[model samples]
Target: MGRLSGKVAVVTGASSGMGSEIVKLYAKEGASVVAVARRQNRLEELAASLADAEGKVEIFPGDISDKAVNEAMIDFAVEQFGKFDILVNNAGIMDDMAGVDAFSDEKLLKVFSVNVYGPFYATRKAVNTFKEQGNPGAIIHIASEGAYKTCAGAVYCASKAAVVALSRNTAYMYMHDGIRSNCIIAGGFKTEISTSMGMPNMEAYGKLKAVLGTAPEPGEPTEIAKACLFLASDDSAYVNGAELAVDGGWCAS
Candidate 1:
């Protein structure tokens, strides 16, 4: 039997990168996944591909920064699959490089709204559902190495740090309720988000490549997805409030 056999999972930011991989992995492990993202066309394409692979996948397109959308996503998952077992808060944004004093308030707020508040809203809805059902559920947040290192701007780093803290506290507060919370402190993953943000310089990218060996090799979305699967499945029954780093040893150096 697959690790996630018979479970229902919800993955935000499911249109691409780590979120897309998480949805694919969950389905491969036999979970029915509700794939949430703002890109409807991409989500539909993902759903179709998963279906072709004999996996159950559903699409729910919306901005996770919106509370109503978050609630709707949970509701959609439950309505389609009867219950929700895993909630992956993977939707996030990174700001352009700027010193604290040079950062624009507009960019800072937008980054926080998506990176911090988006996960918070989703977690709130998921907690309510898990509480009502009284079943064991797992919440996984895709935080960044920025939470621990100073590579990213202040706003992005602070937002991710908040997620880590929130996950730790949630794990402690809801252990009795059979709800487990964990965060993945990822680093230098080659995703659209990274390319879109535009690194400070080619030197910075080259430095990361030298340390990690390549942009896309070590931190593939599929690798992160596997870790998330382990946490979501009964295989990790004892794991909670843990920060799993899928950074290809970048943090080590």
Candidate 2:
């Protein structure tokens, strides 16, 4: 049987990139997935593509930045699939590569709203559901190496740091309740998230050149999705509150 056989999972940002790969992987491994994202057509295509997979994929088209959407996404998973077991808080946005002095309040809000607040709301709802149903839960927050390294703009860095903290805090708070929360410190990867960066401050963008040079070739989304699969399955039952740096040794450099 597949690793996630009979599991029900909620994966945000499932319209494209890493989120899409995670949904595909989970379904292939036999998990019924609620692919949540804002693009209705993309979600429909994704769900249709998985029609022959070992499990099922249903679309939840909405913006996770809204608290109601986050809450409803989890509830939708349970309402549609009978129960909820995993939540991959993978929806996030990036900020322009600007320094603190060059950053704007608007950018900070936009970044944190999608990156931090969305996860916060989704996690809160997931925790309650897990406790009520008395089933083990797994939450994988897709953070960035920027959380600890100067690989991104100040706002992006700060946002991911919050995500890392949230993951650890949730893990500690719910360890005894059979819920696992972990952060994946990702390195440079080829994904559509760059579309959200908009534009970077030319001068401040140079700040990342040095550190970016140390990074290996960009990784594929499936590579990270594989690690997520491990954490989502019973394989990572003992691994909680961990920061698994899937960064190809870039952070070491």
Per-model CA lDDT versus the true structure? 0.85, 0.94
TM-score for each candidate, following the candidate numbering = 0.91, 0.99
Candidate 2 lDDT, tens digit per residue, 1-253? 7899999999999999999999999999999999999999999999999999999999999998899999998889999999999999999888998989999999999899999999999999999999999989999999999998887899999999999999999999999999999999999888998899897787888878988889999999999899999999999999999999888888788
Clash number for every model? 0, 0
* Best by the TM-score measure: 2
lDDT for position 195 in model 1 = 52
Q: Candidate 2: which stretches are off by over 4 Å? A: none
Worst 10 residues of 2 by lDDT: 199-208
Question: Per-prediction RMSD in angstroms?
Answer: 2.8, 0.7
RMSD of 1: 2.8
Runs in model 1 deviating more than 4 A are 195-218
